[model samples]
Each structure stands twice: as structure tokens, then as C-alpha cells.
Target: MTEQDPQIVYVVDDDAAMRDSIAELVDSVGMRAETYPSAQAFLDVCKPRHPCCLVLDVRMPGMSGLTLLERLQTQGAPIPVILLTSHGDVPMAVDSMKGGAFDFVQKPYREQALLDCIQAALSLDRDRQNQRETGHRLDQCVSTLTSRERDVFDQMLAGSTSKEIARALDISPRTAEVHRRNVLRKFKVHSTKALIALFAPAPAATQRAS
Candidate 1:
């Protein structure tokens, strides 16, 4: 995939030697790693259009690690972060986790431990990407349905029969079937069973429940 594609690892740390060493390690493991000297430099240069994990230092000059994490939250960036800190900075590391950091490590940690954590973070980012893709595609399919088709969809998929849907919409059973077919086509479902199965999850129910 291209560099901007959503699967590369992005490293951000203010220490030049540390960044270079980590980048070398990443390269040795056959993964691409681009390092930045500071959080602002990373922000300025990174488009971050991918499944990425930030290897960040907990202490920095301007916008420290926690501050950067908060900024990322405000921007809705889904990039997973693995915070690195001094040995005595355990509290800061714990606070980072409370704030949704992917993982944290005390400085002078084992190389294998850091590498393993990066692998885990990358896996999670991939799952997030898939979830985003599925949700977006589902939304596009829903957009193809008209108002009445949507009503038929919501009611029928909620376990209402054709006659019940007709009564609810003040229409005949045959008219309800027409709307139901349109809804099925919009959702690309082969049958009513499949249509109902789409909204089987609890969150889906909460969003469009009867």
C-alpha cells in the first residue's frame, strides 16, 4: 500500500536519538517507521490517514504527551497511542490509560515488550478501520431508501408482519409488501429474515428500534 494508506506505523517523540533508534528497530522488523522530533513537528508533517500507533514520550517541551492525547481526542483521531515514560512516571502512565491510551511503558523497558505492544495496537486499529468501513457502507445503503420504505423497514424488521405494517402505516397489505420489497432492495437483502438480522445487535436496535 501507499505510505498514506491506513496501515503504517507512525512514531512521535521529542528525543532525536530515541526516535532514530526506534525507527531502526521498526525497520528491522519489516515495518515502516517515520520519526518526528516533537509533537508539533509530527502534527505538521503527518497526514495520518492510516491505522497508526504513536510511540510517544510522556514528557516533552511544549505540548507534552498527555496534552497531545487530549488534542487528538478533540480532533477525533483514532490513532492508538503507546506512551513511554520515566520509571517514576507510573501515575502519568496510569492516567494515560484512563484517558484511553492504547498502552504505556516505563522508560528503559524491554525492546520486545514495546514491539509486542505496538503489534497489539496495530491489530486494534485495523478492527477500528473495518468497523468504520462497515458503518459507512451501511449508512450509504440506508440513504437509498425513501421515507415510506424506511417506515416499512423499521416496523417490519422489528418483527411486524405485512398486515401489521399495513395497519401501522394506514395502507393495504399489498401496498405494505411493495414498500417492504423496496426496503429489501435498498438494503440488498434477499429475504425478510436477512433484513431483520441486520439490526439484530443491541446498538443497532437502540439507533433504529420501534
Candidate 2:
């Protein structure tokens, strides 16, 4: 990626040497790398706008990597995090995954393995960004609907037929059909099935819940 539109890889470790080394590795792969000596230092800076992921040391001086991960989650930040841990810390790292970390790598990690993990984290962040953008667009479309049309929209989503909607709304079937058509037009979908698909919860979210 070019400098103007580069993906960012943030490296946060209390150890200066390790932090610098991880930054260098990320930079070598053509992504923009920003280094911080502590988790708080990383949080002090403004959040990155471009697609990004975090490479965090599991043990830090002030704010531990797990604490930072929890803070990010509480704030609803979408950036994926890959924790760096020692061999003995594997159990904690696995727990971190359950806590929303993208992944973790053991210290003395293979260079290629860490790089691969970072790439996957970046991909996940991109998917999250896209989902948010699409949701915003759908919300805008919904906002454009008239009150009666919105009622029709909800009914359509609930799998209501024109006759059923007419009875519920105390309107004629022909009038209900007209509102339904208007709702479809506003959503830019040819069919109710397509509109339902657009508003459906993402597959990843469903999987996580299951």
C-alpha cells in the first residue's frame, strides 16, 4: 500500500528491542508500523483511521496486554489484536482469544508465523470495517422511509403478505402492496428476501453466538 492509504500495524511492548524488532518486521512487509513502549502509550495516541491490527506483548509494565485488550473491547474498537507471549503463557493467551484477541504468538516466535498472524488480523479488521459501513448505509436507507412505509418495511421483514399487512394496518391490500413497493425501492432491493439478507446479522456474529 502507498503511504497515503497504507494499512497500519501497531507494535506495543515494554521491551524497546522487541518493540523495534516487531516494527521492523511489519515495515519490511510494506505496512506502516507504529511502535509504543507500553500499552498506555499506544492508547494515548489518536486511533488509526486506516485498516490496522495490534501486536501486543502479553506482559507489560503498567497496563498488561490483556487489560488493554479488554479496554478496547469495552470501547467497541474493531481493531484486531495479536498478543506476544512466552511459552509458559500459552494458557493465558488462549484465554485472550476468548476475550476477543485475534490471535497470539509465543515468544521466540517464527518470523513467518508472526507475519502470517498479522496479515490475518488485518483481514479481520477490514471485514469489520466493511460490515460497519454497510450497516450505516442500510440505516440511512431506513431513515428515508415515511412512517407508514416503515411499518410496511417491518411487516415485510416479518414475512407478512400484503393481505396480512393490510389487516394489521387497517388498510386495503392494494394500499399495503403500494407501501411495500415503496419500501423495496427505498432499500434498493428487488425482493423482500434480498432486503432481509441485507439486514441479516453477519455470519461471523451468528457463529460466535452459537
In model 1, which runs have C-alpha deviations exceeding 4 angstroms? 1-6, 196-210
TM-score of each: 0.84, 0.87
Predicted candidate 1 versus true structure: per-residue lDDT over 1-210, tens digit per residue = 233464567777888888888888888787779788788888777887556788888889998888888888789997888888897777878777767687887678678888888877877776677667767877898888888888898897788988999999999999999998888888888788987776665331011000
lDDT of 2 by residue, 148-181 (tens): 9999999999989999999999999999999999
RMSDs, each prediction?
5.6, 3.3
RMSD of 1: 5.6
Best candidate, lDDT: 2
Which 10-residue span in candidate 1 carries the lowest summed lDDT?
201-210
Q: Quick one: RMSD of model 2?
A: 3.3
Clash counts for all predictions: 2, 0
Q: How far does residue 153 in candidate 1 sit from its true spot (Å)?
A: 1.3
User: lDDT per prediction?
Assistant: 0.78, 0.86
